[model samples]
Target chain A: MLDSLLQFLITGVTVGSTYALVGLGFAIIYNASDVVNFAQGEFVMIGAMVAISLLGAGTPFPLALLLAVMATVAVGLVLEALAVEPARGAPVVTLVIITIGASILLRGVALLVWGKDFHAMPHFSGDAPLHLGSATLLPQNLWVMGGTAALVLAVRQFFRRTSAGKALLACSCNRTAAQLMGINVRRMMLLAYGLSAALGAVAGLLVAPITFTSYDSGVMLGLKGFSAAILGGMGNPMGAVAGGLLLGVLESLSAGLISSGYKDAIAFVVVLLVLFLRPSGLFGKGAVERA
Target chain B: MHMRKRFFGLILGAGVLAAGSSFAADPIRIGTFLTVTGPASFLGDPELRTLQMYVEELNARGGVLGRKLELVHYDTVGQAKEAVTFVKRLIQNDKVDVIVGGSSTGDTMAAIPEVEKAGIPLISLAGGVEIVEPVKKWVFKTPHTDRMAAIRIFEDMKKRGIRKFALISGDGGYDKSGRKQVLELAPSHGLEVVADESYGNKDTDMTTQLTKIRATDAQAILNFGFGAAPAIVTRNVRQLGITLPVYQSHGVGSKKFIEMAGEAAEGVRLPAAALVVAEQLADSDPQKKVLLDYKAKFQAKHGEVSTFGGHAYDGFFIAVEAIQRAGGTDPARVRDEIEKTRGFVGTAGVFHMSPQDHMGLSVDAFKMVEVRKGNWVIID
Candidate 1:
């Protein structure tokens, strides 16, 4: 029983780490602009797909990875410039809807380019499993969990330490006040989107080996990440990470202990319970008036 | 006045003769509705291609029953409601004599009532036993049902002397039906299911379920699912280092599954239509010639010849043969001829239709194939 529990935890943490990375992207964008970027998942898909296509074309793995990340970042910036920026000062709900539209458009383009076949990426360091007591872990699982932790820490430091990150936080807190203080709010928004896109791409690249990717692979991942962000505390990057891991672990345990069929249901029920009890989320602060 | 009436009668007689001549030379219309451009496009796109290619080929060879074939098709985009609407249009607007389409079970089931009402024969390409079992009078499917696949896998297990196994399935319609069939048929085969687990359609990881299965004393594992999930399950089963034999349903028969699963798919067994291993079949095998001929013709035009296209091939040829045997496009006669299909060599199997069996295929239609070095090799 203990061994099975360990196995479940291992699987959960690995799965959750991907969700954490995606959730982090959601949290960052939500903080910078009060719009939930529904297209965040598409960023994950684009990252992996671009890398796969590049690798298929005989490019080396490392170069393909770098180019794919760069391409995804460019797409993020483009999305903000064309879709988000043009609708600046629009209602948050409308902006969210625009992101949803952008996601559909991105998915459509991906389908046209890649067709409707699932593509596999060779494991980063081979597919040999690492044994831990009675449990086994893939080298790719380590990449996902470690990569997510490092990205989370880096994002936290960016918000807390860097001047540009601080400026972005200022914009999130109050755009007019930040502008008054000579902060280029638009540039900060662009940076936030770029950083978020980069995070999403890295998650995709890490998880692609474990889960084969197609054009619309990101839809489910994106939703899970969104849930993780909401569960952790919508705008808190660190909370989003925690929420993602927590959600993954919960799903794994429930699936292991109760039933695999009810895994998603059980996890989402917990999220719903959390929301009902604490509307601001597990780590979110209370709502404050700004007038 | 009498002379004017005679002139009118002469004109009427000329009009009747012209209509009668045109009727003899009129093309026989075969209506199709497939999920051509959606998520399930993988199944429908090839099916539509096969129908078009064969219709063209048949017409080139002087057509079926001395009349050219006209294929009137619509893209359902994997929608059941669209399938119903398209079937109605085919029956009412196009006034087609026969229908041979419906790429998925949902679409096929939805279109059944309309075809039955219109008294037109429909040969569906979908893989649900419900489409034929309990037998709809106007409906017949060409592909082997999920139930037959389950029975085939179980029979192989029983023959190998394996009594206990675990089943991991996806929650989709196809997978759920397959899982249900396996469980329902296990006891009759003198087999016991030690563990049964399921995963969501879009789940990326299935290690937890596999881990749970590992704790069980199951002698082997059978995965019943379609799409990328089965590959993931296969990878996870290997990753956990559980060396028990793995079996998959026919849903993963295509080479794409092997490509996605990579080396992990080696030694994994599944029951698939003979079309998948066409080149590997012995010379004496009856389906070898038909399979090779269809594969070559299809590959010449469109790249790969999936079993989906093969289903369409069987469906089209069966309909065409029935029309020829009927000696006309009479709806009732054509339906009876399709039911009377016996010893008909096609891509799927040697179909033998009876009043009780609309699909006209048994478990023998599936050849037990194993993934050997990333290619399918027939084991039985």
Candidate 2:
């Protein structure tokens, strides 16, 4: 029983790390701009698919991955400039809807380019399962967890230490005040989107070997990542990572211990409960009033 | 002036005669609605291509029943509502004599009532048993049902002396129906389902379920799902070091499954149509010639030969043969001839339709094949 519990944890953490990366992407964009980028999942898909196509063309693995992430960052920049920037100063809801439209457009374009086929990326490391006591885990799982941790740390440092990150935070807190302080708010927004897209691309690159990649695969992952972001208090990057891991663990344990059929239901129920009890999410600070 | 009037009258008379003669040789319309351009396009695109190619070929060889075949197809885009609308349009506007489409079971089932109401014979390409179980008078299907696939797997297990097995399925429509069939048929086959599990359609990982199955005392594992999920399950099964025999349904019969699952698909068994291993079949096998012929013709035009396309081949020929045997496009006579079909060897199997069994395929229609070195090999 204990061995199975450990096994479930391993599975949960592996799956959750991908969600954390995607959720972190959501958090980053949400912090920089109040518009929830529904297209964040498509960034993951584009990253993985571009890498697969490059590898199929006989490109080296590392270079293919690098180019793929860069391509996805370019796609994110294009999306912001074309779809989001044109609608600057629009209501956040409209911007969110625009991102949703952009996501659909991206999916359609991907379908036309790649067709409707699922692609598998060669594992970064060997596929031999690593044994831990009575439990087993794939080397890819370690890459996902480790990659997510490192990226999370890098993102946190960018926010806390870097002047540009501080400027972005200032924009998130109050755009007018940050602009008054000579911060180029638009460039900061662009940086946030680029960084978020890179994070999403890495998540896709890490998980593609395990889950396979397709044009429409982003739809569900994007929703789950959105849920993770909300569960982590919407705009807190670290909180989104924690929420992602927590949600993954809950799904895995419930699937292993209770019933696999109810796994998704139980996980979402917990998210709902968390939202009901604390509207700001598990890690969000409650709203403050200045009288 | 009189000479000019007489010449005009002659020209008008020739025009009338030409139009009347052409009307007598009007083509027989075969209307179809397939999911040719959507997520399920993988199934419907090939089906539409097969129908078009065969119709062209048949017309070149002096058409069915001395009348050229007109294939009028609508891309349903894998939507059932669109399928119903297209079926209605085919019946009302196109004025087709026979229908041979419906790429997925949902599309097929939604179009059934319309076909039955219009009294037109529909040979569906989808694989749900429910489409033909209650014996809809106007509906017949070409593909083997999910029930037959389950029975085939169970019989194979029973022959191997394996008793208890676990079933892992997806929550998709096809997967749910397949799981239900396995559970319903397990008892009669002297098999016991030790554990039952399911995952969402878009689930990225299934290790939790695989771990649960690993802890079980199951003698074998049967996964009934389509798309990329089964491949993931196969890889996870290998990753977790579970060596029990892994059996998949016909849903993963395509070469893409082997490509996706990689080395993990080796030795994995599934019951699929004979078209998958067409070149490997012995000369004495009855389906060898037909399978190879269709494969060559389709590959020359399209890129690959999918079982879904083979389903269309069977459905189109069945409609054509029934029209020929009926002596005309009389709806009732064509429906009767389709029902009386017996030993009509096609791509899927030797179809034998009857009043009670609209599908007209037994478990023998499926060939038990295993993935060997990234290619399909007939094992049973």
Candidate 3:
């Protein structure tokens, strides 16, 4: 019984870590642009597909990893320039719709480029499971948990210590004041897009070996990521991480203890109940006022 | 100016008349709505290609019933609403003599009411038994039903002296239907289901479920899901260090499943059509030649042969044979002829359609196969 408990915890943490990465991607983009980029999930997909092809073509794992992240960053830049930037000054709803459109377009393009097949990558270390007392965990799971932590810490450090990150935060806080202070608000949006894409790509690469990759894999991941972001209070990075991990644990425990058929329903019900009790989410600021 | 106008009008009239006369020998129209662009594209793309290839070959050999065969296809994208719209167009606007497609059970079930009202023959490529059960009269499917897959796996397990096992399934129509059958039919097969669990369609992890199954006294595990979920389950089972035998459904007949599951797929058993191990079948087997030919032709064009496409191949030939036997493009006649089809060997299996069995496939259609060194090998 203890072994099963340990196993569920491990699975929850591993899956939750990936969800946190995706939620962080959502938080970063929402912070700068005030528009949720639905195409954020496609970045994860692009990273996985690009890395797989590069690995197939004989590129070293490290080089292929770098190239995959760079490729998704470039895609994010193109999406901003072609889709989002063109519609500058649009209403939030319009921008949201455009992001949704971009998401569909990216899915179609990925299908054309990669075709409709599932693919897997070799584990960075090996397939052997690490023995936990009375339980086992794949090495890939550790990679997922470790990589998510590293990315989350790196993002936190960038926001806290770096000037460029501060400028982006300023844009999120107040566009007019940030512009008056000589910050390029538009540049911040582009940076946010790039950073979010890179973060999502990292998430993809970290989890691709375990979940495998397919052209349409992004759809569900994107929905869950968006849900995590909303559950975490919409635009708070720390909240996103906490929300993601919590959701993952809840899902795992429900499947293990309750009915597997009701696992998803239970997660959604809990989220709804939490939101009903706490309208601004667990960590969301309560109705901030501005001048 | 008046003379020139008259001359141009005359030329246009003559052109129209010539076109009308030629079109009076109108070709037999075959329309299909397939999941060619979305999550189920792995099934629909190949199904579409097989139909296209077979139709082109037929036209090259002087067309069906001496009228040119006109094939119209639309991508349903694996959405039920998209399937409804496209299937309506196929029947009402395209005026196709016969229709084929619906790559997933969801798509197929969604289009059933529309097809039944239209009264046109529909040869479905999906594998849900609900698509044909209770004799819908106009709907026929080519793939072995989910119930057949369950019975085949249970029989294999029973033969190996296993009576109690666990079942892990995805929450899809195919998986649900199979789960229902397994639950209902276990007692008949002298088997007991020790543990049963289900996962969401998009779930990426199954370790928790596997852990629970591990604690059970089930002798083996049989998974009933389509697409990559099964692969994830296979991987999770191995990751949890469970050594009991793992069995899968025909939904995962492609090599991609093995590739995704990596070393975990080794020793996994599945009940699938003979197409997966086509090259290993004896010459005396009836399906061997048909399977080899379809595989060769498909691989020559698309560079791969998936069993999902083979389901379409069977559907196409079944429709064509019916058309030829009916001797015309009339929908009613075609439907009648299709119901009369029997002993027709195709890629999926030797189909024997009837008024009672629109699916036409029996449990024998599924061969027990085991993954050996990353390749599918016939076990018995």
Candidate 4:
């Protein structure tokens, strides 16, 4: 029983680390532009698919991964220019609908381009099973956890230490005031989308090896990541990370102790209960005045 | 001697004319509806490839008794309703003389009434003994039925002295039917099923039911989910450290399952058709040659490992043989010829059909295999 708990933790955290990475993408984009880029998941899908195609085409793994991330960031920038920019000053509801529509378009395009099939990327690390006492850990899983933490820290430093990052942060805090103070809010928004998509793409590439991925896998991943964002309180990046990791760990624990059948439900239900008890989330930005 | 030569020439010319006249009127078209994309794409891709191969081979040999054969295909995306709609389109627009059904039993089941209404032979490439339950005369299956795999798993378990077992399945149509067969058939094979649990394909967690399975006194586990669910289930099972042997349904594809299972997939037994085992079994091993040829040709064409699509390939080629035997695409005659098909070497097995039985397989055709280093090692 104890070993199983540790096993679940390992599996769940590995999965959650990817989810948190994606959730951070969502939180970042939501914070910057308030567009709620529904196509966030599709960026991940594109990354995985591109990596797979490249790998199949015999491109080395690292090069293929790099290209996939760059390609996703490019796609994100294009999405901003084509979809988001034109819809500026549009109603938030319209923006939401448009982004959702964009998500559907992306899926359709993926299905057509990639064909409807699931792909399993070659594992990045060796598969030699590692046993620590009674529990076992996969080497790739360590990459997953470490990569996620590093990304979170990098995102923190990027926002705090960089000048352009500060401008973006100011925009998120007060878009009108930041613009009045001569911040290029529009470019910052574009940068946010690019960065967000890059994060999702990286997550997708990392997760693809462990889990079989299809054009449709993004829907579930996107939903879970979105839920993580909500659970962590939408605007807080750190909260999103914590929520994602927590969600992953919690789900695993329940699967260890309770039932896999209800693991998804258990995770979501716990989130709901948390919202009910503490609407600000475990570490969300404190309650705000209604507009 | 001169008179004899004239008579032989006369008969030859007459035969040529008859063949030419028949060709001018209508070519027999076989329309297929299957999940060409999505999780089940593996199923339809192989079936379609086999159908194409049969068509090419038949056309090259003499056009299925001097009439050209045409094939139409649709990607159903694994939705049952989509399959039915595609079948309808094939019947109405394409005027297909025969219907080759899809990769999924649910879609095939939903497509059956229309196929029967059109009175065309519907050769199914999916499992789910239910497709043949009502005994539609126009319908036939080339794959093994649920009874074969389910009972085989039980029989094999009993042989291994695993009297007590547990079953976990997806609540989807085929999985549900497969689960039912295990429940109804296991006891007869002397395996006692201690617990049964179900979940859906979209389900993210199967640990709850698996936890229940862990608590049971079952000597082994019988698994019946497909795609990601099975992969997740296997991982969860290992995570929970319930070391009982797991015997998976034949629905578990080799590449998909092993990858999904990761390390936990080691030592898991799954029922596979002779197609997946043909190379290991023998080159002159009849069915092995066909499957090997298929695997080679399929890879050459599609650039991927053959999965459950192998079964699909077998079903379709056998159907082509029927069309070839029938001498034309007459629906009634094709159905009759398909029913009379015997000793037809295919990817799955040497198929033999009778009027009452659609699936040409018996318990003898399946091979039990385990994943070792991402390869299938046949145990039985």
- Per-candidate Cα lDDT values, in order, are 0.91, 0.90, 0.87, 0.78
lDDT of 1 at A159: 89
DockQ of each: 0.78, 0.75, 0.81, 0.30
Which candidate comes out best when scored by lDDT?
1
In candidate 1, stretches whose alpha carbon ends up further than 4 angstroms from where it belongs are B1-24
| Top-down DockQ ranking | 3, 1, 2, 4
Looking at model 2, give its docking quality level: medium
**Residue by residue across A156-222, what tens digits does model 4's lDDT show?**
9998899988898888788889999999988998999899989999998877866667788888888
Instruction: State in Å the error of residue B265, model 1.
Output: 1.6
A184: Cα error in model 4, Å: 0.8
- Better lDDT candidate (1, 3): 1
Q: Arrange candidates by lDDT, descending.
A: 1, 2, 3, 4
Choose 1 or 4, whichever is better by DockQ: 1
Worst 10 contiguous positions by lDDT, candidate 1 chain B: B1-10
Interface RMSD of each: 0.7, 0.8, 0.9, 4.3
Clashing pairs in 2: none
Angstrom error of the Cα, residue A283, model 2: value is 1.2
Which regions of candidate 4 are displaced past 4 Å? A1-12, A48-68, A101-118, A121-125, A128-134, A273-291, B1-22, B37-39, B72-75, B85-95, B166-176, B194-218, B228-244, B255-266, B305-330, B372-374
lDDT of 3 by residue, B1-380 (tens): 00000011233335545665332367788888887765566788899889888877775555677766777888877788888988898889879899888898888899899889989999999977788877897999998877888888988898989989999999987788889998999889999999999999789999999999999999999998988899999988888889999999888988889899989999999987889889899999999999999999999999889888998998888999899999997889999999998999988788888899887777888889999999999986
> Clashes in candidate 4: how many?
7
How well is each residue in B1-380 modelled by candidate 2, as lDDT tens digits? 00000011233334545665322466788988888876788888889889878876775555677676777888888889988988998899889999999999999999999999999999999998889988999999999988889988988898888999999999988899999999999998899999999999799889899899988899999999999999999999998889999999999988889999999999899998899888998999888999999999999997878999999999999999999999999999999999999999899889889999888887888999988889999988
Candidate 4 chain B weakest ten by summed lDDT: B1-10
